[model samples]
Target: MHPFALIVSEPIKIDIWSDIACPWCYIGKRNLEGGISSLGDDAPEVEITYHSFELAPDTPVDFEGSEVDFLAKHKGLPAERVHEMLDHVTGVAANAGLDYHFDTLQHTKTLKAHELLHFAKEQGRQLELAERLFRAYFTEGRHVGRIDELVELASEIGLDTGAAREALESGRFAPAVQADIAQAQAYGINGVPFFVIDGKYGVSGAQPREVFARALTQVADEKAA
Candidate 1:
């Protein structure tokens, strides 16, 4: 091999459409990370970008119900059925190393939270903010819809809280959020935790870690070819 011969591998770009309020999205995130880790030294360089997708756009900023109540009404399912579903998802989340607290979860609009994600993206802290928001809402039962609460989360992640507050309050990233939604619609996506790998493959739902690993490996192989 010539010493001047170099191997250049381009990173796979993954566009993820998820809502902060979606339990499956959080679980899927963990599974995706797990998949990447499973590859160990063989893991390909990858860039992930989270896009906005509102699961409940009409939910009030200060929704007056528990997660179960909200789901029951939103899906028009019986209260008992919602409880069963939450229980099942809670177990699934636990398997993904997540502690979902549906009882204490405050179901509210996630538009402001999505806006904050865009602000974080501008600061190159989008991934950090996304993880923080997921844990805050799912495990900590923190209110993610309020500007003040979001600003606090931003501060926790070493962001400029003042700027975060101003951007969120002024709706600076609303259009970006809307654009993401429009793109999702164009892709015929109607679910959360949807993964688009290298603009070629579409992997939907909170799939097992092995599934994600296969997708990543396939894309890497194509790039190599």
Candidate 2:
């Protein structure tokens, strides 16, 4: 037995912070799913929660350009280099079963989208809405920042469109989004796709599935001891 082992049994809780506009955040989502899938019957009971983290909180709702131009200008990189980076990330995402269409992507503020996610969380559909928003932005090029579009997306996922519209219009979940951001700041997390396991272990970036699997296994083992 390990000398430092602590013994307790409980479902593992993973709080993930990410944004829809972040390409790696989408990849990280698939990787985490893959990791859980790899555990198969041996996996422990897990509760996964998604938190708000806007990569571009101050971006305009109606950004007037393609994603490539947005990135090139925002990051001060050459257009060619930005394209190259997008191409490489696209390839990686494709390998993870994600289709990224940077050419048609709409670059917009994600604060509203984050608030919508908080609403979905209250309705017990946060992860579903998160996935939908990610796909809407990266693959479908939908304007997730728009209230009408968000209401439509929520309806597609069987969430009450009227409720979602009211919430968005009233800015009900805005504080929840802000709370998540403040928590992230307290943790010193400045990047997207950050995962906190059981409120103790923090894993950053789009780590490999094996990394997640190992962390889960280790946490479970320590708790079981």
Candidate 3:
């Protein structure tokens, strides 16, 4: 195995292991961006690296229920409670400067989605594709579990659609995706939106902007020491 390199840049590095289908992961991204915005240009340089985590590894490619229904069944919550929870999440998303179209999200597995993410990384458009996938899955009612749909989405992100489709078809990056999952397990991660700063400190969940700001500041300070 190759030796692991520490953050080589002058700026602190934040590695985020998240799933596109996860609502809190999207919120966590906004929170980090918000903290960075508040930190301004002079804020210590920051390198953001995205890793993969699957919230529902065994979910079906063609999930057989509405998102609300799926969540209800999965969590064994009443439909009313599920709706109430979604309403809360929607409000939280709005506060974080995002749109939550929970009703539009398809409840499906995202293994292929992660593979495409790796492909996008090679093309230097992983973040863009990630954002577009989030929007498509969470707000556009798009099915991210299918290769064709993911390829079409890649096209929207200005990625090489043909290459992306071929990669997906050939099951490239499956190991990368699985390696990420294994790393997550090794780190004792049990959920999405897990943020690792400077490869040491970990922050989890969709915390508020202040929380993210503090974490960034702490990591920057520690590195300076």
Candidate 4:
């Protein structure tokens, strides 16, 4: 064995702070995967952890409106402009192989959804749950803010349904969710789909595949040095 042979002390960690209801976050997730794919055979070992960052923490659990309505009212944009924004993003999501049914999306608060993700993290299925929740909220129009709906999502991912319900009911993982939010704030993150690569590099928004590929290659090279 060569004395100076390169060895990874740890997998390159990508901490992504995002919310389920954010369409761009879903697109960013796909773009990150595309970036990893761009690395091909030389891709570095990577570990991704999704952190909670609620886009609308103050939103009611049972918001009586469509996502477009919420966004239009919240941002004070004309309905036409909001629809245009959503249409542009929907097309972008399609390019990334996601079918975003914004018209059918059930807009609701994501606090309980974040808590469910924390619980899934404890059960070693955070990634699965994160993907499921994103798909559910954006594509399937499922009610993520409700306890019954969350339990169904948990069961769909092979988690213990009763346990998930209990966690939501008892607020068991609420602290963990809040901790993730605090950590994001400490990192000075102000948006979703923000990526922190290897704890030093920060990539914001749904960047191109080449961008993520370069970051991984650069980090891997530095580790070898």
Candidate 5:
């Protein structure tokens, strides 16, 4: 055998733009994780960075209505139509092992939640906090828009809640959240759950695990070549 050791390439970077209030974003997250798992032992290492993208920036911090009501008002659709849409997505979420509770969902402004994500990034717990936030908003129907609730969530993920509160209250990470949004606009992305692989390939919507697997494999092959 040769004395030389094998060299491993740098991990592929995946930048994901998503909103906490987006059900599809949560689905996309699970699909992405599934894709990574499908690669098995030979799966190329990947670094994922979550970016902020608010779908309903104009929404009130405390929207006093059901999810269906909020959707009906915001999208100019009837309650029946909104219910249908929610039901379809809820079924889709179930297939992806997500329990979506739209009935109890609090449709509130996610700017504060996004800010908390940025704070988590600085603490090296961005991904953990992202999953927590998604579950909190969609599954548990927790109020992620409030500072106190977000601080509690941060602590759940083993982050420094004190620092998280300070960062959020001071709005220090608001600019970072805005920067991510600006970058998304520059890319002409108008939706959540948008994935940019290696900063070259763009995958929109919550695609199947096979689709993500193929994309990752293709990028790995290209980089290897």
Candidate 6:
């Protein structure tokens, strides 16, 4: 009789720190998903954890006009040049299966959004709401910084609106937001789309699928040992 083949199974966890306002972060997320799915059913059961990292932490609650205007004003670029950049990003986003509506995007700080995401974590819908928030800002052109908009988005994703609003209004999740930022700083992570595989391997930027695939396999091997 042939000897039975041995297969080692293990568990893995991925912690991701990103912000909704970040475009590359969403692209990186899609790449990571591709790598994970390639591992198949026999692969380790992975737990995904989302962390809050606001990209535009200093943005104001309201801006004078469009995203283009805001970018031009903040970066000192010509309005035409900023629009051109927005066009380029919009094209890239579409190719990545995302609909980017920068024209309607209102300039606002993300502190409240981060706090709301922390609130979503308590209900186990942190990942979903995070994705939704990204979509709303980068695609739907919704003002993500406002409490009412966040409450509406939360409710749309099956969370309790009242609870989310309360959390935002009362600043309940402020500590969680600060903690994530502090941890990122502690880890020397000053950017989005940072991936920590099995809590051991860290990858930054919008890495390619193959890179993530290799990291996934490496982490799996380390765990099976």
- The per-residue C-alpha lDDT of model 5 at residue 99 equals 97
> Model 5, 172: alpha-carbon shift in Å?
0.2
In candidate 6, the residue pairs with backbone N, CA or C atoms under 3 Å apart (3 or more residues apart, or in different chains) clash, namely none
User: Can you write out model 4's per-residue Cα lDDT over 63-109, one digit (the tens) per residue?
Assistant: 99988899999999999999999999999999999999989988899
Could you tell me how far off, in angstroms, the CA of residue 116 lies in candidate 1 after the best superposition?
Answer: 0.4
Candidate 4 ranges with C-alpha deviation above 4 Å: 1-8
**CA lDDT scores, all candidates in order:** 0.96, 0.92, 0.88, 0.92, 0.96, 0.83
- The local distance difference test score of model 5 is 0.96
List the RMSD of every prediction in angstroms.
1.6, 3.9, 4.5, 1.8, 1.9, 3.7
Error of 1 at 107 (Å): 0.3
Any runs in candidate 3 off by more than 4 Å, and if so which? 1-9
> For every model shown, what is its TM-score relative to the native structure?
0.97, 0.95, 0.92, 0.96, 0.97, 0.88
Q: Any runs in candidate 5 off by more than 4 Å, and if so which? A: 1-6
TM-score pick, better of 1 and 2: 1
- Candidate 2 lDDT over residue span 1-225, tens digit each: 798998556799999999989999999999999998899998888899999998877689999988888888889999999989999999999999999999889999998888889899889998899999999999998998899999999999989999999999999888898999999999999999999999999999999999999999999898787
Q: How many residue pairs clash in each candidate?
A: 0, 0, 0, 0, 0, 0
Sorted on TM-score, best first, the list reads: 1, 5, 4, 2, 3, 6
User: In candidate 1, how many clashes are counted?
Assistant: 0
**lDDT by residue for model 3 (131-152), tens:** 8888888778899999999999
* Poorest 10 consecutive residues by lDDT, candidate 4: 1-10
Candidate 1 backbone collisions, by pair:
none
